[model samples]
Target chain A: MMIKLEQLVPRPLKDRLSARPSDIWNTTLTLEPGNIVKIKAPSGSGKTTLIHIIYKLRQDYDGSVYFDERPLPAIVENELAIVRQTQMAVVFQDLRLFPNLTARENIDLKRILQTPLYDAEKIDEMAERLGVKHILEQQAGICSYGEQQRIAIIRSLIQPFSWLIMDEPFSHLDNNNTRLAASLIAEECKKRGAGLLVTDLDEDSNFDYTHRYQL
Target chain B: MRIQILTTRIDINFERAMRSLNTLLKKLIRTATGRKRFVMAFIGLSVAMLLILSAVQIQVDYNDLLNSKTNQDSIANFLVVNKVLTDRNLGATSLNDSEIADLKRQGFVEAVGLLTPSRFKASIQSASDRFPFFTDIAFESVPNDFIDVVSKDWHWDESSRFVPIIAPNMFLDFYNFQFSFSQNLPQLTQTVVKMIVFKINVYTPNGIMTLNGKVVGFSDRISSLLVPQEFMNWGNSRFANAANAKPSRAILRTKDPGNPTLVSYLKEKGLATDADKTRFSRYRHIVDLVVKIAWVTGLLMFLFAMVIFTLFIQLTIASCKEEIILLVTLGASPGQLRHFLVRQFFPVNVLIVLISMIMITGLQYGAHIWLARQNVYLDTWLGPTTFIAAAAILGLIWAVNRVTIRKYIRLSTN
Candidate 1:
């Protein structure tokens, strides 16, 4: 599925964005399926806001977002859940995991949220690759920021999705862990022929991106 | 065939996955926080349901006892009704035609037969000197339907040699217990009395006339000497009298003599009947009072229980508000959450209903056994109406749970 943003600007950042030109904020952009897209921005640039807008979480925006041909707001609540479960996945910048749940449980919840897109054993596989396997049984609340970020990345990859949205997914990770987590995400996206939209502070060689935009 | 096998395997996997998911949801939504309140609500609901269902069962059992053929012999369905004899209306105690019509119009009265009294003076004497007895007597005749004795010889015509009579069993008891001992006469059995022939003398304006009368049957329903309606009509018309006297009493056929409405109707109309027959109405009134008390208290308790349950649900949902929002954000649909909450709460209601039903069944069976010793047979099982009431209450609980869950889940999600 392709995500099309039409002249989008966050209401909170509308005035700030008018002072500077952006390649994405006020412009129409379509992230086609199977293409790895990178959005680079400084802090307070509405990068997370843009992701929330596309994810249909925050509707306080000026313009419309479409999943393929259907407008975001046109999808009802249950249909939106289906889209989130099967068509679109996300790793929030805050790493939104149930704090009381163990890291493994947090990821397993997503895996079983719809159908079993991957076997239950796959959680261990992804956790092991990202080097967070030892902390998988630890509660997300007590886990270190870096460990929780890797757990969040594994959670996003555990489900079936055509578009994976990440907002600063590696902010808490070290360089080595970031590369490992990035490779795992790239591999999962490549295996499903799914698109990736990652927002971060600066340009980095995470994956060979088909398009890069300043948000 | 290969595709079908694959589909079945997928279905099994899906089922397993959903089971795990539900377990996780149960862990997250900790309904155990208000355990005390839940237990209290459960107990309240059980007691309420018990009261309500027992009321239904008691009514069913009472009806069965009154109308069941096995208990019919103990209770009389026919009653001889009359106006209460008061000094002011001493000679005017006879019921008017309109009063009889009004009695017929009552829903509880199945049939009314006016007791037509003989207008002329009459006397009865034994035909043989072996039992020489003579007494001034009056005869009353009622319609054939109101007669309880099934005697084939109870019909009369102009050519008949003897008039058939039905003496009240009370009179026989009076004679056997009191009259015979006091007068030094032999106590006669019913068969011996039936075999005796007697002379009936009717005094007319012209002269005295004599006819033969034979006792054909004995009745326990009406407490009077009953003759055939044909004889009474013929005797009253041929013998000289002032005019046809209005009927002072009437026999009523009712399905349930214990009905309170019939009793109240009798009192309201200034009519009277054999108090022994209508004594069942007093017990009925008590049962009615008990049943009504059970109903009102049970319904009030049920309402309070529902309120407690709804508040408990709201409290649980409120406490987990943040978690629910995050869960929804993580793609748990409102439908899923609602289903999970329903599973959490609704099974206990079903269990309560089932437990109440079983208790009522046990009580009914016990009642049946206990009352059976008293010769009042009741069903060993509960009536269909009781089951229907239980199912209706279960359905109502389910609907309430569904609506409460939906409302709270939606509130938290939004």
Candidate 2:
């Protein structure tokens, strides 16, 4: 099933409006299964806002989001998380790692999360693949910045998800690291038959533009 | 279909709630382990305080009520006096046989006997030895205290032809030994004994009494020796007995021989005793005082403790609000957050219930033991039953705390 957003935009935007009346009030986009697309915009653009929309936080918008070709316009409240879990994963820019949990603990959060029973072998494999196997037991806060960022990405990617969403995920990575992360993410999405929607201006990595929406 | 949907939704919610609870529990443990001393203090104090107060009091009261002397009802004798009725004709006196038949038919009485004076010169087949002359007293079949009035025998006595009944003061008074009582009365209570035949007298009524009666077959206390009214009648007729008379003195037994109730029932039936009135009143007063004290103490303690507990919980919840808000912000739904709060407080409630039960048991023990010392007895007070009660009490307390926490959520939402 594909999700299509027609003329979606923000409301009066009381908190984030540091400027005058804006015409970026409406925009249309089509989100399909396993489609790798990016919404490219400047730093201050509402890319994160757009991402939060899919997560159903800022719902004050005039958009028709169709799922399975049906207009899921009202956005069933509790089911939004179900949609997020089976349909999307967001690697937030802040890397909200629970400070109390170790790296391995952080990765294994999905086990204690919505799902019951996480596989130990799968967790170990993901940790090894992300090159964080050695530092799995270390407290997340004590790890270096790059290590924290990698752990965050690995945590997000470790679980099986049908859609991948990110807000400036590569902001802290070099070109080579970005390429490696991109390749790894692509391999993961391809294997799961997942869709990808990323919003960032990481121009140097030169992602073969699947599709781009300018904000 | 609607039922099916509701079921499915409930199932999913149940699952979500479980996961949410598990997550919150694990988080609480991880966080709480760093501050073990605080938890230990709260739990330890709660247990100790509750156990001491609750358990001990329950034990003491329960014990006292059980072992008291008159636990079951009782019957008290108020005034029992030996008196007789007489007709001023021939001095011979005895209860008329027809009256005995009438009393027998009444049927509310136990055993009826003729309680003759010890000196009564009547021969009973059940007696061990033969009684002798005027001064020869027999304790076998009569009230021993009547010997003091042994001065008289009621018969035209001192003659072998007619024997007198050794009826002591009662016979003399009833047959009117001194002329004003009865014109044909026996003269000189004793000298008249050998001269004429005197008869023993008795009146007894009928019923089954409710005392856990002593085995009459073998009880040391026998209030009255029974002279069969049949025998008394035979003697009265055969001796051409003294003046005719009416049946006068006999005792009746009643039912339900226990406190307040027994007294009232007996009073209602015209069988109450003066002693019954006094004892019943005392019991009512003492029971009323105990009940009033228990209720007043229980209410005051409940209200004061509840208020303090509510305020303490309000403060603790307020302090932990930030932690709750943080969880909410992290994509925790309202349901999840509520479950988290409930789960976090789970251990606290368990500790409270456990401690309350322990303390309640102790109180019941004290009550039971105290009552036992005072001779009280009971089978149950603080076993599984008390644990259930404590759990219910704690559950209600927890529910109240949770209801208050919703306001915190509403404020945070706003």
Candidate 3:
């Protein structure tokens, strides 16, 4: 699926965005499938807002977003849930995890939301690769921010999707851990021939981006 | 063949996995927060259901007792009705055409047979001196359907050798107990009485007419001596000095003698019947009152139980509102949540109905055994209407649960 943005601007930052010349805001941009697109934005620039608009989490935006020629706002609730389960995945910047659920359970929920894409062992494998395997049985509430962040990433990857959207997913990770997490994400996306759209504070060598933009 | 086997194995595994997934959903949505309220509501529902179903069963049992062949009396279905004797209507107690027509029009009255009394004077005397008896008597004739006794010789005509007569059983009892003792006569049995021939003397204008008469049967329904309708018509026309008088009494064939409506109708028309036969109406009124009370009380309790159940559901949902919203945000469809909630709540309703049905069945069996010892019979099982009522109640509960679940799930999701 291709993600198309036509003159999209968040309503809260509409005035500030109009005064600036940017590659994404108030512009028509299309991120094609199997392309690693990196969007670098400074703080308070509606970076999370942009990701939410494309994911349909927030509707307070100008212009329209289309997912493969169908308007985003036209989808009903159940159909939208299908899109979320089978067509798109997201890792919120806040690392939204059920505080009471253990890390493994958190990932298992997404895996079983639809049909099983991978066996239950795949959760242990992903947790082990991200070096948070020891915390897999621990409640998400007690885990550190970095541990929760890695858990959230694994949860997003456990489901079937054609597009992966991340909002500063590596914010709480160290250099080596970020590389490990980034490599795992890259491998999964490559296996499915899916696209990745990531927002971050600064540019980095994350899967050799096919297109880089300043949001 | 190998591919087919592999696909079947995969299907089995998928089914197993779905079961586990439901278990996970159950754990996430804990319905145990309001355990005490659920128990109270369950008790209330069960009691209400029992009362309602018992009402249905009681009415069915009462009808069976009244109409069942084993419990029915052969003579109870026919009632001999007459006008109440008052001073103002002393000699005018005959029923007119309009009154008989009105009686025929009543819903409970199946058929009416007017009792035509003999208009001329009559006397009967024993033919043999060994059993000498003489007395003035009156005869009444009624339609054959109203007669409880079956006799082959009950028909008569002008060319016949003798007239057939039916004596009331009360007359024989009176003679055996009182008259025979007072008159120093031997007590006779029914077969002996039936074999005796007697002389009948009808006083006509020209002279006294003599005919032979014999008793053919004994009746427990009508009190007076009965003759065939044809004989009565022939005799009244030939030997009467005055015009035929209107009938003063009628026998009614009815399906339910105990029906309150028929009893009240007779009273309203200033008519009287054998009170012993109509004693069932009083019992029926009492039963009706009891069944109606059960219905009304059961309905009120059922309404309160339903309200409590709905409120309990709302409380459970409201307590877990944030968890539900988060679950929905994580791509849980409204349908999935509603299914899980209904599964959580609806099984208890079905269980309540089933338990109520079993209890009613047990009670019916117990009553059947107890009443059987008293020579009164009822069905050993609950009636079909009770089962239908139970099924209807379960369906109503299911629909309510579905609507409540859908509404609350939508509210939280929005």
Candidate 4:
């Protein structure tokens, strides 16, 4: 699977962030499977907005983003749901977990909808490696920011996907925890032959990305 | 053993939570159940009253029509055709066989009936009467379907001891208002008439034979006193002179009495029947007005109940908006949400309908029994019309509730 962006220009709003020089707004880009790419940008460079538009979550833009040669705007709702469920996974910057649910349940909620793509044992194994196994049984709202970030990352990786998109996933983590979460994400991507698109303000030595872009 | 049981229980809990989002939905419904019941009670009571009132209204009007004593012309398509009297005629006009055959051949007439004159002279006397009352009576009959009085006793047998008679309602009015006023006697009601049997003495060629006569019913449409056609034919054959017998009146059943051809043909033949046709028209208009008014009132009540029901649904859905949004974001379809709503609301409405119908039916039966003790017999059960009407209203409530709940779910998701 591939996602292609062509001459995309978002309708600029005053409150939302947009890239400097507006050059990235008029560019064309493509993301292929099994490739790790880093999008390096400043704090207010519309990074999260770009990720949202590509994931078919936002449509306030001028040009097209195509999924397998079909435009995102034209894809039917059921097909988009299937793609989101089994082919594309995302970790938003806000860690959109149900506050009433446990940290383990936040991840298990996505897994339960699919046909047992990842079992409870696999989930426990991932949580153990990411150093969040002790906090798994606690309510997600009461957990620390760094711990919840790791839980959101684990939740995104529990389902099958051709592309795992992360928007500032390790923003709240220290170097050691960031490296641990990055290692787990890379290993899971390699196992499934999926691509990685991670957005961050600066580079860290955890990931040996295949390609890099600046916004 | 305790550790193993604890592990198994955990697994069951996990499985139940993983199946669907019904756990969350159940929690939401439980929280709002009290408020929902309070609102639904008002709607249910309104609907129940609407149904009961409509059913009672229909039954009462039906009974009124059944027992009405007004002279309703055009109740049947048949018109009584009699020869119009003129100054030049000093005697009664007789309709011969050829005239009846000609009337039958007319294009507008569906069928024709001829009146048969009684051959024997008859007189009536009662022990309560100060003087004997005698009359020359004739009997005319159409098909049994044409008779409006619904009674099973409208039959005759030659060997029977008592003669069952149907008399014109006007004859009773004349006796009560005019004759009884002039004389110092008591007036009679239909119930009293039904109870009094007169002694009839018939003057036959052989001798005078005494028979018992009982009035069975009264008809406003036919001006002459009526007897069963079978008794009249047998009596006429046994007593009357065959050569001189003729029918002076003819009854013709027409497809449409207002048709110009039929009217002009009757005019050409100098035949006329009842002239008070406007009274029948007014009676029909009144019946229609009563029915329409009842329907409109019932419909307004139903709409008001529906409004209350819809508000209740909207409130319940609004309270569960957060849970609904969570479910939708988890990839639950709108159709699934609709199925959930239907499952929740359908059984409640069904219970309401069943309970309301039972109460209304009980009320009807109670009224019937009480009235029967006072000598009035009403139908003892709710009719199919009541059931059908209730079903229609319930189905409407279900449909509207489904749509409103589904819309709220979608709006919350968005």
lDDT of each: 0.89, 0.52, 0.89, 0.73
Q: Candidate 2: misplaced stretches above 4 Å?
A: A13-25, A60-78, A116-118, A121-135, A202-209, B1-25, B28-70, B76-344, B362-370, B380-387, B397-414
| Candidate topping DockQ | 1
Docking class of 4: incorrect
Cand. 3 TM to true fold: 0.92
| Candidate 1: Cα lDDT at B317 | 90
| DockQ of each candidate, alpha-carbon based | 0.74, 0.14, 0.48, 0.15
On residues A1-215, what C-alpha lDDT tens digit does candidate 1 reach at each position? Answer: 98898999899888999999999988898889999999999999998888888887789999888888899989867898899999999999998899999998999889888988888999999998999899988999999999999999999999999999999999988899999999999999999999999999999998999999998
In candidate 1 the C-alpha lDDT for residue B292 amounts to 84
Clashes of each: 0, 51, 0, 0
List the RMSD of every prediction in angstroms.
Answer: 2.3, 12.6, 2.6, 9.5
Q: Give the lowest summed-lDDT range of ten residues in model 3 chain B.
A: B12-21
Ranking by lDDT: 1, 3, 4, 2
Off by over 4 Å in 1: B72-76, B203-209, B258-260, B279-284, B370-378
TM-score for each model: 0.94, 0.59, 0.92, 0.63
Q: What is the TM-score of chain A alone in each candidate?
A: 0.98, 0.82, 0.99, 0.94
> Candidate 3 docking: what grade?
acceptable
Candidate 3 local distance difference test against the native: 0.89
Model 3, range A1-215, lDDT digits (tens) per residue? 98889998889999999999889999999989998989999999989998878877789989989999889999757888888888888999987788888899888888887776888899999999999999999999999999999999999999889999999999999999999999999999999999999999998996779999998
What's the DockQ of model 3? 0.48
